[model samples]
Each structure stands twice: as structure tokens, then as C-alpha cells.
Target: MKKLLFFYFLLIGFYTYGQVGIGTAMPDPSAQLDVTVAAGDKGVLLPRVALINTTDQTTITNGNVESLLVYNTATQNNVTPGYYYWYNGSWRRLTALGDHPETITTLVNNTDGSYTYTSEDGTMTTFTVGGMMVDNGDGTYTFTNPDGTNVTIQGVSQALTILSYDNNTGMISYIDENSTLTQLDMSLAIDSWETLTDLKLNPDNIHLDYTDEDGVTNQIDLTTLVQNLETLTTIVANADGTFTYTDENGNATQIDISNLETLTSLALNADGKTLEYTDESGTVTTVDLSSVITNFETITTLVDNGDGTYTYTNESGNTTVIDVNNTETLTELVLSTDNSTLTYTDENGNDTIINLKTVVQANQKTTTLADGVNTTVSSTVSGDNTAWQVNVATAKGANNTQNSTLGVVKEADSNPTVNIANDGSLSVNLENTNDIKEVSGNYTVLPNDTILLGNASTADVSIVMPNPVGKKGKTITIKKQDTNEDYYINVYGNINGLSQLYTALPYSGWQLTSDGTQWKITNKF
Candidate 1:
């Protein structure tokens, strides 16, 4: 009996390790469990087990048992109790019939009521939008489209016809063969890119926020940008001065043939000077270039003639005389002793008399002439002729009057007064007045005017440079009449561009010159 049991155990070993085949005595040595299912409605059965998800697959059995095959009975994986193979680290469903198909990742989008799918299998098989793929087996791939057309990429593009995208669980839903929606976990794939998290898309705004390489969260509006780019067209400049544009929708826009002719017509006339244009009514309009040629040259220099005259030199160095004087040169003048009436003698010895009255009442010496030009006479004693020093000016010096100030002249070895003629020019005809000035007051530094700060109350004062745009090249100088060298003065407004706003200590003086914009501080003493 013991010998019989040993033989039986040897037979059992042969059955377990042998190449066995059903309904065939001569089994193929290559297949261990090869089953020749004869001509009958019969099939080989596999081990049945409860369904589980990706996380629970490994927990179904322990210790990393590979190449395990089973039939899932739960149908949760959209497979009807079909065979499932465990290869690498996941549970992959297998069909009950033909050979196992490839596992792939897919991307789908809707376009014009139809759907376009892009998928890729691990075997270097790729598909584009509405594109297919075919394996050449010779290290090449052919991608095709639905109309039996191909352009390099070709393969069998499979899809599960997803139903909806779930925002809560971040999964995509697809209808299985049983008319049931099966949820699938979705992921984003970029070529050779590391895994990225914390990226979100806002469906309402159609924009996405993602952390960039610099670790900054930046948002980009992809929807509107794409829409704008789609409508954008590329414009090409033609050799004939025309342009053409082609948009993304395969539409060509052109500056028509007639427009090209119009463009050529818009050129300068045969003289290469005048601009010619043809209106829609076909009327040719030509502008004259004669005046333009003449005006191209500008006056470069305006030299002031000592006798209230100016010589304007053009670009060609040609000078033209500008006579603003209404009277002759005053070589000599007579000042009445009473300081009320004045007289003048011209160079031609012609006496053009003007009645004027001069009074030295307060710090300001007012000199009213019959020409309605009231000259405020102020003085700032400099080096020589302190008693005869005077500065005279009017607020608005119009040429509509005669030289009423001609008789108020106080000629000296060197006249210190700035004589403003009726022609809006300064001279030294020596209109002298009292050099006294009242202090502790504000004054607007007028063109060609001088402000005196001296001898009355406090020495501190203010001087302002008004906007003298139209009166360019005008000057205003401030001087201290009082011998106090420590008086304080606030000079406001950017004068002569020296200092827009500045304060001066006692005995400070400044001269501002206007250049039609702001005043520039010409001289500061």
C-alpha cells in the first residue's frame, strides 16, 4: 500500500507541472494550461472576485503577486464579469472576447456640434483632434482623419463618449454599454513635464490660474485671447504699395485693383513737390507748393537796433528792417523844473512835444504822461550815480501812444534807469525819478520793470514772475534800495528758469528773462 501511494504522488506532480490540453492527447509543449475548447458552446472559467477601485485593488490580495487574472463580478469597471489582468501595479480590464486592447489617455472637445478626440497609447501611438493613427511597424506612424485622409499621424482612435465633467470629485463621466454613466479620473499630461498641482480653471471666466516657474500665481484669459487671435489676419505688403490680409477662416482681404491705382495716384505730382489726390468723385485736387518752398526758410536772428528798431535776418542771412518807432530819435530832451511838464528834441531838430508830470510822493514815484502810459519809477542804487538811478515801465505798453516819457529824462555820465519806449523796447534815454522805495509788500515782476526794497518799514518782501508767454525775451530785475544786506525776500514762480521758487537773504537781487514759456533766472546777485 505504501508503494502504491508513492506512485500516485509522482503522477500528481506530473499533472501539476505538465503541458496539459483538453480534448487533445498530444498537448502543445509551449502552453502550460492551454485549453482546446472543442466545437461546443464551452469556455474556460477564471477565478471570480468582487470589484474594487484602483486603491482597493492592491488590498484585495497581499504581497505583490503579479500576473494575477480574475473575473470581476461587480461590473463597476464597465466590464461584464470579464477577465482582469494585473501586470505592473494596476488592475486593467480585459474584454471577454478578443485580444486585450491597449490602455490609453484621451482628450475630447466639442467643435461645431460634433466631437473631436485626441488620444495617445503608451506604445508611441498618438492622435490629434479628429485625427487617427496607424502603426507602420517599421518605426513610422501614419495619422489620419475621418474622410480617409491622413497627414503623418495615424492610429485607431477609440473613445468612451464621456457624458459630463464632475467638479466635486474632479472626474469625467462616460456612458457605458449598459446606458450607465461611469466616472473616470481625469489628468492633464504635458510632454516631458513634471507633475503640477494647484492649477485650476474657471469655466465662467474661461481663464486659468497656474503657478509659473518663478512660483508666482498668474492668470491668463485663454478664451478671449484665442478668439481674438482667430479673427486676426496677417497683412502682407505688396511690391506695388498695396496690402493683402488673410484671416484664420481662409478669407482673403485685399486693397482692390482700383485702390492700388488710387494709391499710386496719391503720390506727389510730376514736380515731386505738390501732393495730388483724387476724391471719390474723381476730381483731382492739387495744393500749391510755392508758398511752402518760400516758408521753408525761417528767420534765424532778430537783432535789436538801439533806436527802438529791429533787424530780422532770414535763413539766407538776408536782413529786413522792422521799424516800430512812430517818431524820430530823441538826441536831447528838456525836463521841466516843476517836474510836471516835459519836452523833447529829435535828431532832425524837430520838437515833438509830449506833456508829462512826475511826482515823488511815496516810495513809488508815479509819472503820468498825456499818452495814458503811467510809468512807475523805482530805483536800486548800484555803483555810480545813486541819486540819478531809475527804472521805469508800464503794465501794458501799447504803441498807440506817443513818447510822453521823453521829457522826464535825467541824463548823466551813465544812466542807471531802464527806459522802456512806447515801442516795447528798452533804452537808456535816462528817465530818472526818486530812488526811494516802500518795503514789506508783494510785487509782480513785470517785463523790463525793477522792484525796489528799501528805507521804509520792514525789509522782507516778495517778488512774483507772472506768466509771460506772449511777451518773450522780456526781463525783470529786482534790486535793494536799502543798504541793508540782510533783508529777506521770497521770489516765487520759476523765473528765468533759475529757481522756480526761491528765497533770498538780505541784499539779494535777481534778474529774470522770459523765453515764451517759463522765466529763467538770468542773473542772481
Candidate 2:
């Protein structure tokens, strides 16, 4: 009975835990079945299978088993001998000790028909020929599999590696994958390059074909254009702040100035007598003004105050007033009655006398006086003068004495008479003494003629008066002595606002006077 009860308790414990243990009495609580070896040198050996590919699950008899672990022994279809487990409908390889699972991130096709693989950690590995592959050197490579089967594969040309670039020749020097050096013209491969529209041009390196004055075509750089410009000899400042440059041939061109330093300030230092100028460049230049301001005070203006005073102003803006009343001014100069001294009087009524005898000596002379017939004489004597007078005595002419006389006589008179009065006056009598000028035809009036007598019996007479420009208040009379025809008196200037005057009757006359601008008829008869 006791043995049976112990066996029943054991069976209930097994049912309650539902665990299986091998070679041990206690099983782990986390696992359904636990296998353990107590003291043996044995290990669990998993089942081994040949997997054609990771995705082919039909190779395993229990292909649907998701977590089935196995050791793959196949080397075909990229499957190697490794431990793998069934996961998500594929056989996934397990990493060995000290190994990391790397995924291929990139693949590059090489020019030599090989492929380069880049792993996720940036490790690059090249896939050249396979392990069993050999190059035949005749555009083909042979691959030998483990089954002893040989296969020939076509080989591509070796890829080229760029070693250097020659910009001047537009060529590239490179070495091929076979270690052979070669050069390629970049100009021939220009179509493979991208067009650059914003390339910076270097003036010194760029060349151009230029035709010179001698008709020679020469290769020059862009900088040559600036070097060939006309050289300037002189620069002049213009009023508009521009500069005019004159070349050697006297041709001038104006250039606008920019970014030039400007004068910031100009000041004068009175103590140092210097003019300091500062520019925008923070440079200061000093000019000595000692020569220009040599004098401390320079009188600029002087005003005479009419009241015997004057006001003067200096360069320093100071004014000074001066009185000239006390200054002596000459008023009069007199000579003494004896002619021995001269006296000068000033404005202040002061006199200064000078002795004339010391300067010059007086000269005196005397002569005897005599009287002629019928004359009485008197003589007086002075210091520097001798006076002598002779008085004639009145005498009556002889009662019967007659004096011969000369006189002028007219052509119609036999003789002319002249009389001498007792008062020493003479008188002569002539037939016709009137100043008369007779004109027969055209005659211009003379400046000194007082009367013009015209006889129009043969032809009409025309008398022209003198110009009245300078002859102001002068008079001339024109008379028609005969009445056979009318006589005309003409004046070059206006005569009483008329140019001429006419007289028809005998003894008719007109007297004209010059009123400066024109002649006026003052009298008509």
C-alpha cells in the first residue's frame, strides 16, 4: 500500500508540471523539455541537410517548421557550410564567433566586367574572378567547378584609372587596371563634359588674335588691351571734380574720380603760424604761413574825419583815431619892405623869419635924365629905383603953316582931303568907304563879310550863306542892288526853318544871324 501511494504522487507531480528531464530528476521551469548530461563527454548533434538556396524550403522534410535549426552542408547557390535556422519562410544564416553580419549596401559595375560591393559599414570588397576562374589572356576567362567542369567566359577590356590632368593640352594621363599608362585627349571627349556658363575667365591666360597697325595678326592677351592704351603725360583738375588726362600727343580725355580721399578739415594754427590740412585718409599736412603773415599789424583802411582827425584800422581788426590839429600848416609868406628877410605864418598864427640878404645880394643902378626941345624933365633917386620923366610943352602950330597929308581917294574922286585937329586927332574923307562885296552870279558867303551886294541884271544871282555850326550870333546881309531879276540867298543849313530866301524888288535885302544850329533872318528890307 505505501509503495503504490508514492507512485501515485509521482505521477500527479509529472502531470501538474508537464516537464521532461533526461538523466536528471529535476527539470527547469522555463523550458518544456531539458536535456542535460551529468558526467559524459557527449553533446547534442543537430540534423544536417543540403540547402540549395536560402529561400528553397522544400529541401527539408518539415519545411513548414518555422524555428527548425540545422547545419547546411551545401556550397551551391551562395549557400555555405554554416548553421542556419528557418525564419520567415527562409533559411537565415547565423553569425559565427567574432563575426558581424554585414549587408551589401552598394554595388558598382567596373569597366572590366567585374563588380565592387560596398557593405553597410562602408567596407569595400571587389568581386574580380571567382576562386576557380582563370584568365586565358585571349578575351576570355575559364571557370572550373568542383565537379571538374570547365567554362569559358568573355572578358571585357581593362578599366582606366585617372592619374593626372593636363589643362594646357586638354589631355588626361591614366593607368589601366592592367597597370598600363595611357593618355586621352579631353577635347575629343568634350561631349561627355558638362557645359559651364559661369566659368571665371582669366585675362592673363586667355589669348586673342589681334590685327595691329602694321596689318600684322598677333596673338595677345586681354591684358594687352590695357597696356596698349595711350600713355598720359599730364593730369588737370576739372571744375566738376573730374580729372582730364592729356596724352603725349596733346589729346585730352576726362576721367571721373571715385573713392579718392577728401579733405576733411583745414585749420590755421595761430601760435605756430601754420596751416594744417587733414584728409579723409587721416593724413595731416602742414604749410608754414610765417611768410604770409610776417607783420603783426597791417593798416588796411584810413578814413579822414574832416574835423582835423583820421581813423585807421589794422589787419587785426583794431582801430586808432589820430588828431592833426596841432600839426603846423603854412598860412602866409611875406617879404620885408627892405627885402632883407622873408616871414612865414602858420595856421597857429606863428611866424618864422628868414634873412634874404644872406641868400642873395640886391643890384642898384642910376642914370642921368635929359630933356629935349619943347620938353621938361624931372628925376628922382631911390635905393633900388631911378625915376625920370619928361613933360612936353604945348605949342600952337603956325597960323599960316600948312602940313602935307597923305590920304586915299576913290576912283571917281579927283583928290581926298585929310584934316588934323589941334587935339592930335586925324580925319580922312573918301567917296565910298562902306565895306560892300558885289556879286554877279553864284557866290558863297564869307565868314568876315558883313554885307553882300548882288546885281541880277545879267542873270539871277544866288548867294550861299556860310555854315552856322561855330558862327553863333554872327550876322550877314544880302541885298539885290539891281531889280532886273530876282536874287536868291541860299543857306546850307536851315535859315529861319527854311533853306533859302528870295528878294525880287530893287534894294531889297535880308539880314541873317547864326543861332548855332541854324540861320535866323533877323531883319528883312
| Cα lDDT tens digits for candidate 2, 418-514 | 4455765667643233246988888887655778888887677777787788889888878888866444433344787887777667888888888
Q: Measured by TM-score, how close is model 2 to the native structure?
A: 0.19
> Largest lDDT belongs to which candidate?
2
lDDT digits (tens) for residues 421-472 of candidate 1: 6765766542343232444677765433544553313556676667768768
Q: What is the alpha-carbon lDDT of model 2 when measured against the actual structure?
A: 0.60
- Superposed on all Cα atoms, the candidates' RMSDs to the truth, in angstroms, are 34.7, 54.4
Q: What is the TM-score of each candidate against the true structure?
A: 0.19, 0.19
Candidate 2: pairs in clash: none
